[model samples]
Target: MKAETVRTTLTIPRELLEATDKAVLEGKAKSRNDFVVQALRRELAAQKREEIDAALAEMASDPDYQAEVLKLEVEFATAQWEALQLGETPK
Candidate 1:
């Protein structure tokens, strides 16, 4: 499917615009819009990764979450032992 695009104007420093033009001429990007879009996508992905990392860090510090994980670990261990005794491997 083709995505819709909107025309927008931005104010950038002269040197930065010059650099972007140079990059476009070098075939690094199809155009200034493409370069900007790629940059935005990369930055958005980076921000999303940081958000996930922060959530994981917060979850690690959560005592209730830790207790639940430990409980599950013990339950799984017992189940695995029972399966082994029955000569069946638990998946």
Candidate 2:
């Protein structure tokens, strides 16, 4: 399936545009359009990850969530310790 695309004009620094063109000539990208699309996708993905990290940080600070996480960590450690005492080799 082909993705829907739009035609638009952008004003970028001359040096940056030249670098994109060079990528095409160097066979790093099939064309200027491909380079720009890949660049935009990377930037968008990074932004999304930043947003997710921020949200997770906020959640981590919540007292209820913190307590639950702490409880799980303690249980995990206890289980590992018990297993070791039983002469079980952990993978």
Candidate 3:
């Protein structure tokens, strides 16, 4: 499936543009547009991962959430033991 795209202009530095052209020539990417799109996608994914990590850290520090996690761990311990008894790896 094709994604919708917006056309725009960028003013990349000379050295970077040279490198980008080299990469495209070497088939690292199909074109400057594809290179830019891939780079932007990677950066956006990293940013989202950072946001998720921060949210998880906040949740880990919350007393109620921590207690609930511990409660679930305790609840699952018996299940893990049963799996071990059945010769499974207990995950």
For every candidate in turn, the CA RMSD to the true structure comes to 3.6, 3.2, 3.1
User: For model 1, how does the per-residue alpha-carbon lDDT over 8-73 read when each residue is reduced to its tens digit?
Assistant: 999999999999999999999999999999988999999999999999999999999999999999
lDDT of each: 0.94, 0.93, 0.94
Clashing residue pairs found in predicted model 1: none
lDDT of 3 by residue, 1-91 (tens): 9999898999989999999999999999999999999999999999999999999999989999999999999999999899778895564
RMSD of 1: 3.6
Candidate 3 regions with alpha-carbon error over 4 angstroms: 88-91
* Model 1 alpha-carbon miss at residue 32, Å: 0.5
Question: Better model by TM-score, 1 or 3?
Answer: 3
Please tell me which predicted candidate would have the highest TM-score against the true structure.
Answer: 3
Residue pairs with clashing backbones, model 3: none
Ranking by lDDT, best first?
Answer: 3, 1, 2
In model 2, which range of ten residues has the least summed lDDT? 82-91
Kindly list the per-residue Cα lDDT of model 2 for residues 1-91, writing each as its tens digit: 9999999999999999999999999999999999999999999999999999999999988999999988999879988898788886554
